[model samples]
Target: MQPQLQQQQQQHVLLQQLQQQQHVLLQQLQQQQQQYVLLQQLQQQQQQHVLLQQLQQQQHVLLQQLQQQQHVLLQQLQQQQHVLLQQLQQQQHVLLQQLQQQQHVLLQQHV
Candidate 1:
């Protein structure tokens, strides 16, 4: 081959190799960027999951407190009902005693 033609062919091959290397480097950079985005998304999801668990725990605690308050209120109502029942019984006893005394006086007068 002529010397100038040989040098031109070698230069062409070198240029093609450099272009291929540039393309490969571009592809590698794109893949790395995609991986970084995925890692960021995964971290966000984990943070959201942790926040959801904390909210659920708080809800459970509030529910337990509400149930305890309801139980205490129920106990107070029952005690009030028991007191009212006792008062009614005492009033009935007093009325019965009064009726018996009035009957005894009427019977003596009739005799």
Candidate 2:
């Protein structure tokens, strides 16, 4: 009978040891899960940073295109203004010639 009681006690100790080992394994699994989550967050942040850089690059290119277009438009406007002024000058010269010819004809009639 004493041997039987001793065996039961030994069995209980073994069972307790197994429970402890199981608890340790659960703790390790929880820690691993936490590490995995942190790594995922870091990866997400890196992707966002890359996307932001791409957007900034696109914005810069758009700004350069707008500036180039503005420069071309300004040049065209200057050319158009120059042509208009030249035409106005030519018209004034022709009007002056017509007035002078009319005055000469009137003077001849008066004679």
The 10 consecutive residues of candidate 1 with the worst lDDT sum are 93-102
Give candidate 1's TM-score: 0.80
- Which residue runs of candidate 1 sit more than 4 Å off their true CA positions? 105-111
Q: Kindly give the number of clashing pairs for every candidate.
A: 0, 0
Cand. 2 Cα-lDDT: 0.99
lDDT of 1 by residue, 1-96 (tens): 699999999999999999999999999999999999999999999999999999999999999999999999999999999999999999999999
Q: Which sections of candidate 2 miss by over 4 Å?
A: 103-111
lDDT, each prediction: 0.98, 0.99
Error (Å) of candidate 2 at residue 110 is 5.9
